[model samples]
Target: MFRLQFDLDRIIGTLEREGWVVIPNALSATITANLRTACLDMWRQGLFHEAATGRASGQACRAEIRADSVLWLDQVAALPAVQAYNAAMDDIMQAVNRGLYLGLVELESHFAVYPEGAFYKKHLDRFRDDDARTLTTVFYLNEGWPQQAGGQIRLYLDADCREFVDVGPEAGTLVLFLADRFWHEVLPARQQRLSVTGWYRRRRSSMPW
Candidate 1:
């Protein structure tokens, strides 16, 4: 009897104005804990990279080798709490695609781990001149993160570099925003700052790739 939950209009409006919105407790603590364990195991096996060579430059662990690569996604999808995450996204995309003819939704995801003094430079998540990549989502993984830890995302909502918003990397929080609308960066983390960031796209034409 668990119907889809979340305010679609509010989220869209917030994204338009603030450039981002964070949803708290998007996943249960139990699942987050299990996912942390799974990621740690993978980390021990050397399955991730220490850097991503692009708009981001930071002393952080990156796991961008695969979309939905985290073992926990598959493991917890069956759980109602976890399934809500997917369902909410599906609803968000459906609403976005309704006004556009033949637009398609595509998604890719990865994880980033910011250790002491780790950070990323400001950049847009999509390729310019292409409006197909509609949005981006980042899920954070770190319990009881401190404000002094300095792991916050600084989001830009203006072209002249005047407007901005800062979001913290609190555990079980998910940040979603339009991909092209903002330029953002992660502040240096004093401790381990972990997150899974990704994008959702819409095809520009027929036979969309």
Candidate 2:
């Protein structure tokens, strides 16, 4: 079984203090390479669909607002790499919940492929209609990605959006943040980009029914 090799204490501490944390080498090199290969293979097989904006009835494909293709991981959980990734994320969820008491109980994730020039505008992960999503996590799988790639995730540190940080789409890098509190965007890249993006969710206090 694949295992995550990272300093959990430091990571949890940073997240508790900053509300966001970026960790390098969050996954082993072998697992990162495997995930990258899986993403590209799936893309070549035409398993990805154009990603949409909004939620439920409001969702629609708006290229101007965002441009990326995605393959939901729900149906592919048995894949070896995917299972390993899920296991790692579960560990993270448990740690965060133990440390922060966020009540995160589940994870929803997808493989996102950004073709050249693809981008996503600034937005929060939690939907206006549904607030179950409590935390956002993004693990990049682009091997040997460079600073010049331009496919960095710009994370806004404050509500006013003045303070920010741009994180590169580099392999083995994981970004974690409070889902509803942060505004973020994907900067357009000259080449393709690949990552597994997910949200850790809590049970809703009341159902829509």
Candidate 3:
């Protein structure tokens, strides 16, 4: 019942050809609703922290760059919904490693909440000092999000940042892209927005530290 809703072959093929893919209804309605409720409960409990940018010493909360709040999934891993989500991601990780040979070993995810007028400026997923992030995954949990409500993710297709695509923040929609390649950003929403954003990582021989 908690299985992923994506076509494994299609996902692999599209990512290989385009370096990115936006899949609608990537999760079942039951799982989506459970995850959404869990996220909201965490938010209400004040478990989220203001999102930051950069890495390690460079990490700082810069509202100018991003204004979302996040609660790391590990903090709520015991939750049934979170466990189901993790299991589903683990399946994808294995498939990707087998099909694309990305060498991804684990996934780290967080629940992100963007209040009204919140936005994240355009940026790539890989950090300047970190290259472990092999792939980026954004699983949206906003139910009944109308296009007019305005929280769309803008993905830049070319290095010149010209050609692009906009994906609505709809429930069960999942966006995947090569972490170091595409540039993307969240457009300001007229209302609140929610999502589980994560990165698939591979083992590194050495650390910058």
- Candidate with top lDDT is 3
lDDT of each: 0.64, 0.91, 0.93
1-209: candidate 2 lDDT, tens digit per residue: 14677888888899889989999999888878888888898899999999999988899999998999999998777788888888889988888888889999999999999999999999999887788999999999998998898999999999899999999999999999999899999999889999999999999766464
27 Cα displacement, candidate 2 (Å): 1.0
**How do the residues 89-177 of candidate 3 rate in per-residue lDDT, one tens digit apiece?**
89889988988999999999999999999999999988776789989999999999998998899999999999999999999999999
Per-model TM-score on C-alpha atoms: 0.72, 0.96, 0.97
Q: How many backbone clashes does candidate 1 have?
A: 0
| Clashes (N, CA, C under 3 Å) per candidate | 0, 0, 0
Off by over 4 Å in 3: 205-209
Model 3: per-residue Cα lDDT at residue 9: 85
Q: Which of the predicted structures, 1 or 2, would earn the higher TM-score when compared with the native?
A: 2
Candidate 2: pairs in clash = none
Error of 1 at 132 (Å): 3.4
Ranking by TM-score: 3, 2, 1
Per-residue lDDT of model 1, residues 67-175, tens digit only: 1223334433564534555555566567656633325475555556666777777778776445666678887878899999997988887887688888889878778
